[model samples]
Target: MTKNFNDLVADLSEIEGGYAGHVPPEWLQGRTAYGGLSAGLALAAAQKAMPDLPPLRSAQVAFVGPIAGDIRIAVDPIRRGRTASFIGSDISFEKDGEWPMGLRTTFVCMGERESSIDHVSHDYPDVPPPDIGKATSRGQALSFLQHFEFADIKGNPNQGPADYLRWIRVAERDGLDPMVELMLIGDALPPAAMKLVEGFGPISSITWIANVLTTTPETDDGWWLLRSRSDYARHGASSQVMSVWNTRGEQVLTGMQGVALFL
Candidate 1:
């Protein structure tokens, strides 16, 4: 059954030790849930568990195991100070017989403060605005990718340079929180280094580190520019640096991801 992003999150239940949730069959990436969805839920749970937290500033996600059928998420407050809050989250699911780790995360939230320093080292691509009329399904993406639409896409998976640039957005983003929305759409692209692969193969996102530039960042019709490039790929792994920009050309989130490729 097809469901919106919000619906999947609403399916979560706050249990005793943690929260329980379910993923629709279509959202599965290989044997696990989409990296974005699973990670989004963990962040959502943390927001629900503690409403007093400030805007999200940074986050670290470890895709430790696959998450299908059912999910368990637990969030603990590592510290809560005057302006910044640090919280950790753990997501788990049962496999054949044992409970394996699904996702482990740490989120940092901090309010805006008066500062003489404010800058971004990354540059927004010189591409024109996303061709709204050209947004369409590539049809070659994973099952969960059907939930999104891409435009102004650049880069060929069969070619080199190892990068993908596109404007992407959720089909249904009404009523969704900004941070939560960003969390789900941030990792929408495939691993950058995969561009050099000749064929599709097993790929796992091992870790993700994200730095939020603005919690109030917004884009036209929910579209965000996603730019990712892999400067290094070796043996059986790849590391990518990414940046998300809103329609206003504002940097929303800067992220780094590690992927394990079995190609």
Candidate 2:
């Protein structure tokens, strides 16, 4: 069945032990579901497990195996403290009954805590607005790309400093929970390894670590600025840094991903 971004997130429902959901093939990168979908669902399950929990402080996800078809997600609380709670989540494809993907995150509901320092030293990059660029067309190249839109802001990656900037958003309007939004957009960028080569190639993310600065920011127009750069790529492995900024140029989430470059 065809499902939009909201539909996809809506399908995730809290069950007795955890959550249950399905991702349509339209969002599949290959035989496996899109990395963001799996991660987002896991985070959603985490949210359900701790509905009154605090905002996400840090989250690490390891893609143990392909998560596709129907699936069951279970969340476990590692530890709960007054100010912070650590959570662990796991997902298993229902068809096979073998759990693979796993996520661990720390949430903090900082109330009126006294802090000696508060500062943001980083600055947002200057880039053209999303409307000024053309919508990226993967052209049935990958069924997954159809659900979202992209505007390429930089040219060939191999010819430059191996940095990529783009504007991305879902085609359909969907109200996503805060944690769910962070997980989905954090993995939206095409692997930075693609810039290390002459053209497109196969790449799979083995591990992803996202540090959410705050509750997911509300998107005024649903557009997010995706900026990514690869720090190193060697021996069939690449490490890249990525960030998702809202339309107002605020850094909502930052992450690092380790990918297996098949090229």
Candidate 3:
């Protein structure tokens, strides 16, 4: 049976070193699972290993290989400082009699302290609000997409600038940690290069770096603005600048992703 994000998360069992979990095929993208789910699971394992750790400030994730079926996430606390803690988590599983690493993540969790300076470097995209009554759709018929709701804003790439803008939210968001929630929805959009390609092709995210702008990232009615801009695309690879904002027009998270495109 297919399981939602919350249900899957609740099934994670704590092992000796980390957490053990399973990913159903309904959440798989091709041979692997969704990028957001892997990254979110790594973060979730890290949180479970150290419950008192501070809020997640930033995360650096490397997608090494395909991860499906039963998985083991080993968490290692690299260091703990007065206000910040650094932890490393690795997701791996045995397949075909060989253990292949699926994902490796380094999390920087820090507590907020008074700073002498504060500034805003970006603003929310000037897009219309997400219509809750409108129907949601997905660009591709990937199996994992059914877990989330996408209200895409149609546009023409020839107008002025080109980008993928949409409002996305999890279909099952009850009782989710704020940090875990961000990880789940942050990488929900496909590579911005998908619009630039003519026909459909396989694509995978190689690396992703996310910075948490605020500890308490909240939006109205679970709707968050998602924008992905591919500034460079060439030579079978592409890079995108990703951002997520709340309904109150607050910038919550900023991310950069490197995708390996097989055009």
Models, CA RMSD each: 2.5, 3.0, 2.0
- What tens-digit string does per-residue lDDT give for candidate 3 at 1-263? 76888887789998988988998888898899899999999998888888999999999999999999999899999999998899999999769877689999999999789999999986566666677766565534448888888887766343224378889988878888989999999999888988886767999999999999997888877778888889998999999999999888888999899999887
Stretch of 10 with least lDDT, candidate 3: 154-163
Q: Flag regions of model 1 displaced more than 4 Å.
A: 138-142, 154-160
TM-score of every model? 0.93, 0.86, 0.94
lDDT of 3 at 159: 24
The superposed Cα distance between candidate 3 and the true structure at residue 11, in angstroms, equals: 1.5
> At residue 111, what lDDT does model 2 achieve?
30
lDDT (0 to 1) per candidate? 0.84, 0.72, 0.87
Which is the leading candidate under TM-score? 3
Deviation from native of the Cα of residue 144 in model 3, angstroms: 0.8
TM-score of predicted model 3? 0.94
Tens digit of per-residue lDDT, candidate 1, span 123-147: 7775555666755553344488778
The candidate with the higher TM-score, 1 or 3, is: 3
lDDT of 2 by residue, 2-82 (tens): 776667556777777888888677778777778887777777777777787777777778887776777778788878889
